[model samples]
Target: MKLSLLLFFTCFLYLQILFSQDVKKQVEVGIIEHLDEFVPSDIQLMNEDGKMVNLKDQIDKPTALIFVYFRCPGICTPLMDGVADVIQKLDMKLAEDYQVITIGFDPREKIDLAIKKKKNYQSLITNQNTDDGWRFFTSDSANIARVTEALGFKYIKAGTDFTHAATVIVLSPNGKITRYLNGTYFLPFEFKLALIEASKGHSGPTMNKILQFCYSYDPVGKAYVLNVTRLSGTLILSLGLIVFLVLIIRKPRKRNYPKN
Candidate 1:
C-alpha cells in the first residue's frame, strides 16, 4: 500500500507539470495579428524628460514601438540591443526618416528609470544627431492598459515582474500599426523593408507565424529555446524553404538610397 501511494503521488505531480506547460503554451499563442489597427491617440504618457505628452504626438513619422519595463530581467535588454543594432546598421537618417519609441508597461516604473534606460541605449548609437530620435516613456496603468490592449500586446504580471512576448510593432506616420517583427534578432534588410512599408502607410505581413514554430521562451532559463513541440518540426522546415526562396529572389539594394 505504501509503494502504491508513493507511485500515485509521483504521477499526480507529473500531471500538474504537464497542465502548467499547456497553460503557458496557450498564453504565448494568444499574441496575434493587430495589423492596420490605429493606436490610441488620446492615451497620455510621461516622456524621458518627465513631460506629459499625447502618445500620437511623437509618431509623426514611421516609428518602431517597443513595450518593455526597465526592471525586466529576461528579454528586454536583448530586445533593445537588437533595435539599437538595426538603427546603427541602417543607411537612413533617424529623426528625418523614422523614429524609435519605447514605453514602460509597468506603472510602478518611474520617469527617472526611463531616462536612465534611454541614456544607456543612446550611448550605443554612433549617430549623435539621433539622440532626440529615440525616446522612452512611462505612464499610469490606466493609460498603459489602453495602449497595450489596442495593440494586442498581452502580458501577465507575476509578483513584481511581467511575462510578455518579445516583439516589435512598426507604426505608420499617423500611428497605424503596419507590421509586427517577432524575436530580438532582426535582419537589417527585413527591418529596412518594414520601415519603407510603414513610411508609405502600408501594412506588411505578420512575421510571428514562422517564429512561433521555431522558438518559445523558457521562463526558468530566461531565454528562448528550440520549440520541439509535436507539429513544429514540419512547419519549421516548410517555413525555412519559403524564406530561402524569398531571399534568393530579393536583390540587395545599395545602402545609399535617399531617405524619405
Candidate 2:
C-alpha cells in the first residue's frame, strides 16, 4: 500500500511540473536563443529607400541586428540609443569594420516612418557617417516571422503595443548568430569582444562558451563582475585543502625510544 501511494504521488508531481512548463512555453515572450544558426538568406525586408533587400545580401560585414517598430513607445528608443552610444564610444569605424541593421517587425509600418526614424537617430550621432553604416528597414508579417523565428526573437502583439525584450543580436559577416547582448545599456569591452567574435564567426553559448562567461561586464557599475557561483565553488575546494593541511601539521609525530 505504501509503495502504491509513493508511486501515485510521484506521478502527480511529474504531471504538475509538465503542466507548468507547457504554460510557460505558451507565453514565452522573449528570445529563444538559436546560437550559431545562420539567418535565412531568403528572408527579405524593405530598406529605408523603399527597395526590397534580402537580409543576407545586406550582411556583408560583422552586423548588429536590431528589431524594432518605429512607433514603439517603450524599450525600442532606449535600445536604439544604446546602439548609437556604443557606436560613438567604440574606436571601430561604423559601416566599415561592422554595420547595424534595424528591422521593423510591425508589418503595418512603412518606409517613410523607417526613413524618418533613421534620420532621427542619425542626427543624434556626432561626426559619424550614418549614411551607410546604420540602416533601417520595414518588413511584412511573413518575412518578420521568418527572420524573428530564425533569430529566436519572440514577441506577442497586445492591443496596439507589443511585448518584447531589449537586446542586440550580433551576427558574423555571413549572417551567423554569434552573441546576444542583453538590456538597453552596453559596455564597450563586452561589445567589442562580441563584435570581434562575430567577425570570426564564433557563437558565445551559455553553457559551452566560445567567447566568455566568467567575467561579465556590468554596465551600471562600470566594472567586470566575476561569477559568484564559480568563485564560491573555488573557495570550497581551497577550504578543503587547507583543512587537510591543518590536520596533517597538527597530527602527533612518533617519538624515538632510545634502547628502553
Candidate 3:
C-alpha cells in the first residue's frame, strides 16, 4: 500500500512539472523582441482628430509605442494606466524630449473609440496642455499588421478577445526599436534610462533585466514574483560564500616563531 501511494505521488509531481512547462511555453509564444529593428514609417494611421498621418512623421523624438485595443476586456487598461503613471512621474518634458504613441491594434476599432480612450488617459495627466505629446491612433488591419510586425509584437485572437503580453516598446528618434519593457508595471528609473538611450538613437538594456532574472511575472496577480530557479541559484551562491568564510576563518594563521 505504501509503495502504491509513493508511485501515485511521484506521478502527480511529474504531471505538475509538465503542466508548468506547458504554461511557460504558452506565455513565451506570445512574445517577440525586435531589439534595434527599425519601424516602417510609411504606414498610414488616423489620428485622434481623424487626420491621416504617416507613422514616420509622428516620431520626431524618442517615442514610447504601445499597442492595445481600446475595448480590450483585459490587460489593456492596466497597461495604459501603468504608462500614464510612469509618464507623470518622469521629469522629462513631453513632445520636447520625448512623446508617446498609443495605437489600437484591433482594426475594427474606430476613430471615435480611439478619441474617447485618449481623452480618458489624457485626463489622468496633470499637465493638460501637453496633450499634444500623447497621441492615439486607429487604422486598417493592414497598417496595424505592418507596425506590429515591425515591432515584433504578436497576438492571437481568442473568441472575441485576444491573448497578448503587456509590453512597452521604446523607439529612437529615427523609429528604431531601442528597448522593451515587459509587464504592466514599469520602473520610472528604467524608463528614464530607456528614453535617454532612445534619444541617442541606440538600444540599451533595461535596468530591470537583472531583477527579471530573479522573478517571473504572475499574470493572475498582475505582479512579478520570485522565480524558484533563480531563488535556488541565489541560495546556492549564499551557501558558497558562507562555506568560504568558514574555511578562511578556520585556516591557522602563520605561527609566529622567535625569528633571529
* Candidate 2 lDDT tens digits, 155-232: 778678776766799999999999888777988888898999999988896431211233333334433356676456
The candidate scoring highest on TM-score is 1
Error of 3 at 147 (Å): 1.1
For residues 115-198, what per-residue lDDT tens digits would candidate 3 score against the true structure? Answer: 898888777898634478888999999998888888877777767766666789999988889898877888889889999999
* CA RMSD of each candidate after superposition: 17.3, 9.8, 9.6
Query: Which of 2 and 3 is ahead in TM-score?
Result: 2
Give the per-residue lDDT digits (tens) of candidate 1, residues 176-221.
Answer: 9999998788898999899999999999777464455456666777
lDDT of each: 0.81, 0.79, 0.79
- Which is superior by TM-score, 1 or 2? 1
Off by over 4 Å in 2: 1-27, 206-260
Q: How accurate is candidate 3 locally (lDDT)?
A: 0.79
User: Whole-model lDDT for model 1 versus the true structure?
Assistant: 0.81
Q: Give the range where candidate 2 is weakest over 10 consecutive residues by summed lDDT.
A: 207-216
Q: Give candidate 3 regions above 4 Å deviation.
A: 1-29, 205-260
